[model samples]
Target: MRNDIQIDKRSIGINFIDGKASVRIWSPDSKSLEVKLENKSIPLTKDDFGFWTITTTNIQPGDLYKLVINNEQEFPDPASVSQPEGVHGRSAAVDVSSFNWTDQSWNNLPLADYILYELHTGTFTPEGTFEAMVSKLDYLKELGVNAIEIMPVAQFPGSRNWGYDGVFPFAVQDSYGGPEGLKKLVDACHAKGIAVVLDVVYNHMGPEGNYLGAFGPYFTSKYNTPWGNAINFDDAHCDGVRSYFIENVLMWFRDFHIDALRMDAVHAIKDFSPVHILREIKLHVNELSQHTGRQHHLIVELDLNDTRFINPLEEQGFGMDGQWIDEFHHALRVTATGESTGYYSDFSGIADLAKSYKDAYVFDGQYSHHRQKFFGIKAEKNPGQQFVVFSQNHDQVGNRMLGERTSELVSYEMQKLLAGAVLASPYLPMLFMGEEYSEPNRFMYFVSHTDKELAEAVRKGRKEEFAAFHAEGEAPDPVSEETFNNSKLQWNLVKEGQHKTMFNFYQQLIQLRKEQPALKHLNRQHLKVSFDEAAKTLLLHRWHEDQHVVCLMNFSQQEQKIQAPTEASNWRKLLASHEPQWLGKTEAPETFEAGEEILLQPESIVIYQNS
Candidate 1:
């Protein structure tokens, strides 16, 4: 029987075609390139389009190979689909078609319905593998989250990393079960009706094992970021470079079957071309969504407070579905914990929190004291759902001087009140892993760089980065084994003592957000906040059609009696943070009359509904 399997020659990596393997690579600066498979060398022909290609039958799936450029250096494939060996070793051919996918009917969840759970795979479980994560799918399903945003899983330099240092954008980390393990994990998530959103770093690649610079001008010195050199998106010979990263976005959605991508730190991606790189990606993803009959979303992480990132392209915007709003976290944190340092210096108390809750962006073209400039554009027309708000995330918690999470910074009652405020807001809410149950472990910055020189450099850099905060002791070594081990989540604590109550409270709040039309409708126009700065109290009112939800919170440290909102007539108490059933000592009346005064304990929130 003659095999008629055909693969696109323009594909970036090793592709199987009719019992033969066709390898294509982008190496514009190299004089020549060759593929070494099974001790046999095959020369590749370079095309005018800057791609070098060779077709050979000797290269099969699972065969180890390396790229020999200009007869001098041998490096792993830049777009290797699976780096079975370490980053410094050779790459292996992966047959993506071999994995069995059972999620034929799985579609991406709507933006309005995304209750995001952000997790770092290396620390989320003790085993720290994709297979281990599958065992906890039932727990996540019971927790009532519809989406999971995985931290970056690309191949880094060593056995462990926070994943931001990933060098090879296409290869899954070998230690984290590689491509096959990830497929099984994504499949398991879909089987449990959970959508997978992958976090990808496009601003910069890791320092070590980055060979793209050896082959071409992949970085530009025109702009600088915290990460060394910026990617060459608009510089000379950048068409090929732009295509390289854009294809990466499609690879995750097409080959890995990811429902969405969360682009990390897009503000660092500087491009001045006629069409921005972000705009190009948004246009291509829009096409992919229409062609595949599957929903694909792009959520960008930017602190510039620019609305163009989430606006529709028809209105001269980038056309992303959502953007992570760090200001929301800052406003909530400053109000809840009163930590006014660094970026937290800009936000005030309950008034700022109320502003973020109602307008989506608190710094809407306002002068920022921290930045010392007018920082953000207005987002008046944008719906609240376009902004993903979170009380605690990796950066806010992990980047701290001691890597302490919110549970350690605030009182237990304050944690519960903050949870209620986040869940009841009109914006989409995200829960950092272990945050739902107030896990005690610190999500510290950890890595395992194999190169001693590079490891020492990372340690020095970490210390210098935290110098402004005046950390008490020396910063923890990023490459230390102890740091990595200590960051793992203590999953057993989720069912013990007060932790169990917090977990159950999270579940109930998630269910209420899903069932309540007012919560899920995500209309900022209908979401109202009335805050009294003197009393340190806030009243949030949300309504859709005839259904309404009223949440009243007290941030002060003493018991206080506050007047109900004018629209609080015929309201029934749904949830109170001080109830004894939730490990508290106080409870409110089940029903209340209009204009009645309600007593609230310190750092507590009460939610009411009118049926």
Candidate 2:
């Protein structure tokens, strides 16, 4: 039982211990398993737990090998840490302990201090490598985000991928500089006082070059996922499958020193075991922390607003440290852009936005017209920092037919308002790549699959998804090089007009979110959110101890009237979108007192703090 189990560090795949190479694999479905090195194959002894193990000095680092199943078919190790020749090629032996890390005194920041900037490695820069991203860390530090959330880096087919199609769970994307590149990047980030958060897809492996099924029952046929077969977590022989993924989780924290992991699409993870796989992962993380004496976090990206994922393990929940809330983004987007299509149609603008500010889940136990059912449950029991809110993310933008970013879809002033709404919330705020500078680049979905049929299927799926969102024109070819190239961010835009202003505005907002007493602490209980539907305005008031701050936002195209909170007097202006520096059309005063009527500029936000 997990209650009595005191987990310790367990090594999977290839490892070097006591001056010898030890190879381990779990394959119950195979009658015979052999480790095929250059020009030779060695048999491995299988134990009762269905894991094949061998310790020998013959296999060493830098040697390429494959696992021979049933003395015929060959495939890479399921937990290969190095895939030098893409997903279909042989797995290279990697000495995991070789990387020299310098940040020995590095410690993680409090979760409330995390202002995450989510970026895709392939599209973040022109060079599109971990080394290139390292050069931009200083720029990110200046932007005031304390952490960066990198998209999935697990090895995938070919060169280009959103990374959801990864086949090797333990391997770093070779195209993105492999394991060595990632280590350098993480080390550099720690030196800059920045935390690294990696996005990992655990629900399903990509279809192309996926050979895990050949060795063992890694996937189950009883259940289906939107992408492919659901992972075999709760079905027969589930213990091995659970260990496969749980070990993957430990590999990142123990070997790579990743500060946090964002588990992608947990809603699709079909697990019905007595002890859920996610909970087990959390328990293992705790044990790993104890062994390593370091703090690690597991933040899940789930569409379901169930607090069970964030609830404590003692309370019969999965005990994830944090979760991304999309309803907050949907509400703020619908309010600012007036986009009432698809899921946006369900949100009633300011009312839903206000609800999200207070409860984090807007559709809690309410009927959702889009999903066509009662969606979510109340998450008020969870603290504010446990919820991460974002206005633009990879999926929220890239999945579109044209893949237009929020900058292309909304006005300049409205973008400022959206940024304010996210930062002002009591939850941790995340910004999509290039959003800080309002970079005008389409983050289209692209993948370079060796399988022609799979590429065509992806194109068809993208077209159908676009149609569902009522998009016009032909969808961009998902497998085309043009599609991938066009998605690259234009770094030159940061030196230009409104983009520069937007970047400065974001820096101020992020700085204020860190320095302001009321905004710095994420206390949902001390926050009061209210909105006027007729005026299309929302007022958010937050108080921490003796400090009080209020943010008034006008989402309408025309100027709207708003009133300050009655209790707080001598309110001084800290930041406002209506300020001339922020490029607002209408000029506004610097300060407003309690119960004062203020005419806010169209599509703007003003934050006032009591002196």
Candidate 3:
């Protein structure tokens, strides 16, 4: 036996027998650590590193076990991979190698051509299980989505949740059909040529049923988050805590065969170390990717407008593949919906949209009335592909007073314009599930907690949080079964006339993106945007070599026109919101021709290619 390896202090019993199951746990603070299996207690033999081990013939895969620490408090294994019931229940032993994977020849889809679809697993379907979601693979594939970004599936203290309240970082949620179920889903998706990106929350665990502190100093009270104490990533004994999370990231890719991971609210991770946790995670994931011959990606949900997240460290950057650019979404939303409240207050007219499109940041060192301080860095030189743009996402939709979508707030014509702006942009595009079909149902926040007191608090807090919006009626109790049912996608909506039209339009837009080289190029400096601020219209020109594509958007509700600039003469209408009507207006209007109008329908967007 190699005595140089340091054993984990929380391990109970670890025996590396040829056929028998072995378990190990380290409890240096505890006088005794016993493994309880099938109503029998087996005392573990303590080793040098506070580890206790036992090789048991009866212990096998699918067995339920718990560790009695200090002979007083019983807890699940801290390194457990499957919590079959809930975070508070016994950990289920699972043999990852036992599950037969069928995606042997699966290769990850290239990130450059990705159109990510983000979905919440709990309310994505009626059954809300991983097995049940297999039926929807065809639907997503048909929608032209190359990747699926699933919301967090880590074990929390409930049977149903939005997944932000996850406690068990390593274990897959039992309510979502456990570890085997998720593996099956990933394998199925790979076979269908779809990549899977898991959304992980490492900022802080849920309020209840979290036992990380009992084993070691995994949290620190030095800083306070909206939830509570921040994770102890930069404090004493922090290396072990960091290693614990990094290992979890590796486990997902190596065992589950996940293509990528989306780190949730990375700005909240609050690390100030020499080698940041994110950088360390990137290094390990990259190493694993090379060893396994699989492409692994890390996407961060960063609220800060920092370019360092995507820029290379040689250039003094954080080295993330990409980060969610809310500025683009906010700018698009303001132009589409004309709503200016909360964060949307800073976003107003075409100026913000033009700025966001040309340079991925609207608040680039500009004075912000919202933050009462200068915010964001200038990203004028960065490649657009390093940012992910969206019109609607889980945060924008679910955080609403009633979880209403853009379809509910804006006109159909405006939605098409929003679609044009997102699809035609150089940045990678993402869609919330059912957004393409303009589905009427909303995705409300829902959860089912085992503790009644915590459930009541969640319900009350949800209602009070929307008090400023003056929303009608009390907020729906998230714990109610009705909330979950109401959030499900209505498939019948796709067959309806207007919804079907919108869906086809989205499909065409996606196809256009894939077919055009100018649309895929991530270069930002080569693109130029001009807007007639007074007329509520804008023209975006993207050029590579001698080829160029021009996109025009009309933000006004009423029909209006503007004299075309000199470059417009070379333009030909390739795609339009109201196509077949504006086919051949190739000749550019006189540059100095004032009051010379091009007819535009209310809230219509048009795209023109240089022929």
Candidate 4:
């Protein structure tokens, strides 16, 4: 009954106590349940809480076992913390308390001060292991990134996956060095003064190795998700289902020492309970944070522009810290590349980008051509840190026909322009892995499913999806090992010519964002954005206290001439992408005169501080 691991306080998973192991399984629908371990079968007793339990002195850590339902149907533990072999293998007992952690003095940074760098464990490095990433902590720190949002590490079908296909939510991927490897990475990151954000999927389970239905009604038939049946959060016997995922959230924060959880596609999580599941998670996370005396945050990936998610709980909302704003990326991409195929059709260029700067949502209450309906609610009341902005992310790149990154879609100057726009905004900025140096490799969607039929179907689905973009030629095989190899980041490019320059440009921009008074504080109320449609110029003016900063951006391929933003012009140039040091083709004066016509180089950005 003692809370050894704060998450294990529920007493659902197998726990070791006083030289004995206690096993518990929640199978409300099962008439009988027993443990099948080694060569023996141990029967379990059912309780009023609908969980079958047993205690045996013979069990030990590292032992693999499965639950036998009604003495016939056998499946891995639903609350397994270690799936050693794979998702289909038996669950192994893991003693998380055995690891000695030295992060006692470490705590997470405030959400407003975060500069996030998102990376996939498999593709971020060649070794593709959590332990392998320890070597790059200093590199990220040097790049001015204080937090890293890692893609999912749950136990999936095979060694190669996007992690959304994970079946065991509690277990870390065996190919990624498992739980111990993850702990070491977190500990090292904390030592380097970097926070860790983990991506989690609760919408639906993967097709293969998913056996939750055999135990109980973990899913509901009333509503559906993009994957299939939705989680049973509001249906019959939903308390157990809610507890299952809430405990998972606590497990990551308490056991792994993760600072935040990036919930994947929260719009897909169909829940209609009296109190939403997200609110429950927020309540529990707040409790855990209070108990541990560490700051923890919940960030959601929501398609809708609803501000209710980030609104405080007392205001009858979910109270999430932030959500990813895809509209900003869409507008910036359309402006940079002139690509308006699928969803990009909804956004108009610099205007939306400017709107996203002042207001968090560009499509707020506007009719979306792609959806053929009025979408989004205005979120201007929310603070800047309530939204996260990026020019390139996993969905923006991998969902493409060729998986081409933003760097591949536009010229070098345009890439710099996009980075400047994202960093200058009132919201928090994020950079996809390999984006700082503009790595040439692609981030295609690749998978390795054990089921041959399912694998083939995935390839077909990918091809059909590409039809929306009207891409020519066949897509590279997603199931091919070669595809996974092609997606890995080219780390060597960092030391190369133009790539190295791009890295410095990003580093300077981030450093200015943190050090400058106007840019450091994420205050939406003290910013103004306006765009000239004819000249393809956007002006962003931000101020905090008395420090004023002006960003002049030219999005056109041709050079633009714009009037000065202020009549009194004694501005200090903080950064100019057209400078020779930034590998630019043109140069401009360091200070601007009053009523002067400033010439902006094609596809370049210039930041000036009012002197």
Candidate 5:
């Protein structure tokens, strides 16, 4: 019957056309389906494609409705745009063309210029709403971040979540000011010349509050994910499921005016099909971007260390714009802290940092002690701009036993040094929320599942996961309200003593990176990195055309002398982390000559510009 039907690919959801409503839902399992609205049941005719359709003037914008399957079971529409009363409640019909948008001149920024700041909508501000985030746009703009990567905001179980448990793919989170509030936030961000990148999960849906399985076979037990069952991408009757998610992505770009999307944990997306779902998503987004005349970019979060995600489509690869590179973070963390445990065991010395700086990935086709196998392919030819590097992110911090940040593990001087390395690297850099001022709050994992058994299981499972850390006392309960409350950033600390000084240091680094041609070049060919094993020091040489800069960093506890190149030349002191103005006790040096010995303070970094 499906083979004999001719279904419009674009007519899979509720649509408003010329003062009339057309409703469409695909549910092969349901023997009968009806649209329930205004305490009235309107029968829908089933098509050969297993999709029920109804054309009527009864449904209007702002109408709350549900789909009744098998003439007995009622569930919220899976394609709902707004779930005002939680995920399990009735869905509200929305007319996306009604919103007033002022970002007509805005375009997606290039990957080379991205200075991403990742934040969670619920924990970013005290108010924990999109309206609250709008007030902080000026603050983020002043922080010199050109892009804000908001964690997933799709509708989840209840009022509070990290958003990865979202079940309604199309519905905006009700607690975070809903759909209208999100549009306002996007409009404000574009007005400030700041791009917004939203995190989206496609590998699996949440266990609770999902009615998708009741409608059709949207998931497969054939494969397993760490979270749950994987989405049915290559399984039987998977076409409608694929279209559902692909259209969801299109809705974000075309309807919400989102500039880019960051796909979460793409390595978990298992597709044995000849054409992967990732490629389909890329092609569809590309087509939508051309028709809408808007620049839309796709970024994937993968630890596979595969360069094919960033490769062009014509090269038999998924055409993604960029990807998150964890090797850079691991190398930098091990080099600074000298902690070799868990995944950090694979990297131990400062040479690892140099390797990452040179090739973008340090574990390229190498034996990994942590993984106990040869891991990752070589990506030496990829542009550094395509790799998004960060010293701290939600996963790096929250996945730990105590949810402690790098600032908590290292000294003040090391924090400055780490910031310098990340900001100065040729790769695009991202900062976790509240990382600028070293906000002391912990970003612990928290959720509010309505199911009692599921909540207790999450708490018990988290304790077992961190048993190897040997952390003091017990782990925090992830389903507790206190855990979520404690994770909100302490915004008042930014103006206090050392916090203000550290914030100022980040501002200077960002300003210099943007103003200097050599820093913005972001080309690995123009960058050279070398480190001293015995001295515990690293040096980077970056140049573009005639402008050049040399960075000297000392990770040792004692002061060490580093050398400049042998070529006779004059250099001026541009910036130094040890300067008294940056809350360091050392006095500032004026200049240095080629072949000169420069003394670096303990755990400090200094930058010199060729004059």
Candidate 6:
């Protein structure tokens, strides 16, 4: 008794009825196109433009289907909105509107007030499940982090990875719980006033189980990246490829109520189109924000040092909200460890630190011997919060020959100094997981790949890659299960002496950032940094209105006496690493002689506030 729909041969299109689904695909090169249903096959009629259309009344949501192009079978639509299973498996038809959202009062937090905490879900807890992470929401709240930026959670080959190698862009990783688990996690976070920022990888898919090529021309050989052939963002049929990614980004915000997205390795996305992919993504995100009445933000990770990424689209730029300030971290690392190999070759001494603190870009318009070309541009006036600075992050720790943290390589006094420098800088500060407590464990690179040959190759390559650093001992085999186990955070360490000291230090620094009006100033013009290169000491002065604060760091091993700047005459000791008050000892200085010679402990940093 149901009406049979007749298709017009002149046009190709799809109409989703109450109980039936229609599909249309365009492939001029294919001799034939067929719809492979779960129980039957329907031949699609091709129009003059080589487009195929087919409709079936029996097909409904949750039914799986595939397309046959020129006798070659492929996965569901390349622009599939949901891959409920995995990438290599069948794609299910999902009704996105069916899921009822519980968050009606959630809104994105202001970027200036955001204190981001970057965490990897797989190793954040022993269970490594989204539900397990929910138990720790109170812990993050207590630490004063407003946003949690999770590493890539897209499905990959196995249970363990950094998630960068994810191939299924739509499917959540099965091991860390799936899409439902992620939704629950986001909802829980919103309930507690925490914003969720997902780290998404678009430059390249993992080597294993990637099937985008079988579905369509999602990649191009015109350009290549370190991972392999780059995504075909500018080639023919690229419109759909770009839409696929843009839709995924929108899905995160619309469905999960995610506030922000941190794009991974944007430098590898090679797009020469007049409207670049990043620009298009930003435009779409802004539109979505307008429609939903909720703010959505996009942060990019670019190593090119181009300010164009953060510039507005109307101003002829990429229009990203901000970028990770790797140069700031590099400067901090080089200053703390005094290691100059590899990328650190461009960074040394207090000059680089001064530039990173005052301008947020140390290599701006300078001839970098590393790239052999001028890198970066001067940030626009009042663009202080456009850069995110940190002393340590996932890449910095995991990429090392041995995953060594700043606490492992440098003394505790130096760790406190680095923390102060990062927190008091003009840019936004990000804290790596367990960095506050100075966790002794290193976060090594680990993957659970079943293929022995590929696993062995990765293990060998990781070891050989570190030969340049002259790292001692054998590199931790990334393929080994022990590698993954070693990276889990040991929460009990917080009770120990050294880790407790660092934890309290981080708490004090965060409190200072909140209370000090000078530290909250985002204007680069209001910042002044001076350093004694010969004495291995640096002083950062920040002022806004009538409030001023001074951050002094001593990098030398022996006690040194240095005269305070003229403005520091009214300085009162607010925090000190060697001060016994921070460590339960009674002997602590309440005040220091102004403009007079003061002795600094080896590798100590002190903060003074004008009374």
State each model's C-alpha RMSD to the native: 3.0, 1.5, 4.0, 1.9, 2.3, 5.0
Superposition error at 304 for model 5 (Å)? 0.6
- Tens digit of lDDT per residue, candidate 6, span 1-611? 00111211111223355556666665545678776768887778776644566677765776676666677766554434345555556666544334556778888788877788999998888888899999999988877787899999878767889999888776677778777788899989989999999999999988877767765677899997887788989998776577667767877787667888999989999999988999988877777777778998889898988888899888888889888989999988887788888788899757799888877888889999978888888775527777888999999999997898887988777888788888888888899999989888999999887678878878888888887777789888898778988999998987688788788778888888878888876767887898877778888888888777877888877777777667655678778877775552223355665676666676777877777
Give the residue spans of candidate 3 off by over 4 A. 1-28, 42-58, 467-473, 563-569, 579-597
Off by over 4 Å in 5: 1-11, 566-568
Each candidate structure's TM-score, on Cα atoms with residue i matched to residue i, is 0.97, 0.98, 0.91, 0.98, 0.96, 0.90
Lowest lDDT 10-mer window, candidate 2? 1-10
Q: Mind giving the per-residue lDDT tens digits that candidate 3 earns over 1-611? A: 12222222212223224566677654545678787877788887777655567777767788888888778888887777788767788888766545688998997887777889998887777788899888899988887888999999988877778899888887888888888999999999999999999999989888778887786678888888877899988987676577678777877788798998899989999789888888877777777777778888888998888887777756767778888889889888877777787778888768898998888888889899988889989875567767889999998998886788888988777888888889888888999988898888988888878789988998888887776556677677788888878998887888688888888888878887877777767678778888877778887778666667777788887767755445534556567785532222233332222223566666777666666
Poorly placed runs, candidate 1 (over 4 Å):
1-10
Of candidate 6, the 10-residue stretch with the lowest lDDT total is: 1-10
Clashing pairs in 4: none
> Candidate 1's C-alpha lDDT?
0.86
| Model 4: lDDT to the true structure | 0.89
lDDT of 5 by residue, 1-611 (tens): 12221222235567776787878898977899988887798888888767889888999999998999998999998988889988889999877556799988988788789999999999999999999999999888898999999999989998889999999888899899888999999999999999999999998888789889999999899899897788999899888888788878888887788888999999999788887888888888777767877888899999888888788899888888889988899889988888776788789668988998898878889998888999888886778788899889999999887788877899988999989989999989999999899888999999999999999888888888776655567778888889999999999998999899999999999998998888888889998888898888999989898889888999889999888864339888778999889989997477888988888899999988888
How many residue pairs collide in each prediction? 0, 0, 12, 0, 0, 0
lDDT (C-alpha, whole model) for all candidates: 0.86, 0.89, 0.78, 0.89, 0.86, 0.78
Q: Write the per-residue lDDT of candidate 1 for residues 1-611, one digit (tens) a residue.
A: 00111112226778786788877788988999998887798899999867898888878899998999899999999989888788888999976656778999888788889999999988989999999999999999999998999999999988779899998999999888999999999989998999999999999999888988887889999888888789999998787788878778877887788998999999899899888888988877776677778888899998888888888999888888889988888888888878777778888978999988977788988898888998787899998778888999999888986789988989899999999989999988999999899998888898888889989998888888776666779777778888888889999999999999999999999998999888879998888888888888999999998888889999999888877666656888888988998988988879776777888799999988884
lDDT of 6 at 67: 65
1-611, model 4: which lDDT tens digit per residue?
A: 11222543545678777778888788988889998889888899998878888898867899899989997988999889889878888999876555789999998999999999999999999999998899999999999999999999989988999999888888899999998999999999999999999999988898889989989999988996777899898999888888888888888898899999999999888888778899989988888888889989999999988888889999999999999999999988888877889889888888888888888799889899899999999886788988999999998999887899988889899899999999988888999999999898999998889899999999999899988888899888888899999999999899899999999999999999999989999888888888898888998989998788989999998989987767346787899998899898777788987667899999999999888
